[model samples]
Target: MAELIDVLLFAFLLATAFYVLLSRDLLAVVMVAGIYSLLSAGMFLVMDAADVAFTEAAVGAGVSTLLLLIALTATGRWEKPAGHRVVPLLVVLATGATLVYGTLDLPPIGKPDNPPQVHVAPHYLERSGEEIGIPNVVTSVLASYRGFDTLGEVVVVFTAGLGVFLLIGGPRRRRGGEK
Candidate 1:
């Protein structure tokens, strides 16, 4: 049943992606992108990645969609045509192919003997409470072991929000038009 839901969600995501790519209407594209993000959040939920799903729902579906809609309101609703697509198309195909090829080298999902499980996971699970003094292993890993990475992610999200704010024309003018 879970696998069936995953497949359906994946299919919906693919269809939404294609629609977003083919549609020239910016509003329609933004709406479909939100749908894609929602499907992604659902997929993460089904995979038991609640934290990731929450981020996807909040950042991807919520913030990103709102920003895009705001930007669309400021800009034209139609996308301008490009002069050349061949180079961009080639680049996209190459990147997609490389990603698919790279995934082939990944260990199968839930494989107990995988490198992370064999090496890093055990150390974290056993010593995290002792070293970091955090009862929850996930919190320990994110807060202590992977602190820099988590900080980097937070910084990126903050930067993106700042960019959106700048794009949306900042704060409203005062009654006296003071700077």
Candidate 2:
């Protein structure tokens, strides 16, 4: 059953990725990309990284797509063709190779016998509430260790709102009218 779910999820992610790549319509591509994020989040959850999956589901699949859609609306839909440029393709290939190489060093997913995660996490899980005074480990970790990142995210949101307001609420020019 789990295998079937994994296969379906993988199919969804790959299909959406293909749609994003092949679609000429920018809006459709953006929507497909959002679906890809959502599918990826689902995959992460299946792998038991629930916190990371939650973040991916919210920020990647929800907020970022909305922001991208709004920006696309503010700008234009048509993207320029890169038919003449081999550079971008080469860059993507190189980055993908680098990522694949990096992944070779990662601990195998869901290996209960893995030494690294087992060593530190059990202690953190057992004592985090006592140490941090928060019942939710995720909230405690984020509010403590990742406080700066959370603040930065808030600042970014504020800046984006400021930009949108400026774009939509610019001063009106009095042109040949008595007001």
Candidate 3:
């Protein structure tokens, strides 16, 4: 039953990812991108990572999509790629090849005995309560170990909002060729 559910979720994520990448219309692309985020959040939920799911649901499914739509309204719906260039394509292919090579060195999925999980998480779960005084390990990890990084993420988001508002929300500027 669990295996079946995992297969279905993976299929959904894959389909939505394809839709996001292959959609012709900008609005459709944006909608599919939002769906991709939602599917990712669902995957996180299934993996027992509630904290990650929460962030993905809020930021990926909600805030980022809204910001993208706002920017789309400010700019235009259609994207012009100018011209297809081989240099960028080659770079992308090289990077992707490197990533695929790196993945070969990773531990296989769902190994009964994974070294990192066995060694690291147990230690955190065991001593976190005594040192951090937090019963919830996830909350402690977020608020302590990566607290500053999280704060910086929020600051970056706020800055982007300010930028979009300044660029799009203000009075229209006179065109250069206006009489």
Q: lDDT of all predictions, in order shown?
A: 0.90, 0.85, 0.83
Q: Write the per-residue lDDT of candidate 2 for residues 1-179, one digit (tens) a residue.
A: 88999999999988998888777788888888988999999988988879999989999999999989998998778776658668988999999999999999888877887885688667667888788888778777677756899899899989988998887666765542656
The TM-score that candidate 1 achieves is 0.81
List pairs with backbone clashes in candidate 1.
none
List, in order, the clash count of every candidate structure: 0, 0, 0
Could you estimate the TM-score for every candidate? 0.81, 0.75, 0.78
Candidate number achieving the greatest TM-score relative to the actual structure = 1
Better of 1 and 3 by lDDT: 1
Give the lowest summed-lDDT range of ten residues in model 1: 167-176
Q: Give per-residue CA lDDT, model 3, range 58-136, as digits (tens).
A: 9898988997998789778876654777898899899999999999999997686788779767878888999899888
Clashing pairs in 2: none
The superposed Cα distance between candidate 1 and the true structure at residue 83, in angstroms, equals 3.4
* Span of 10 residues, lowest total lDDT, candidate 2: 169-178
Writing each residue's lDDT as its tens digit, candidate 1 over 101-170 gives 9999999998999988898899999888789886778778898899999999999989988997896556
lDDT (Cα, 0-100) at 34 in candidate 1: 92
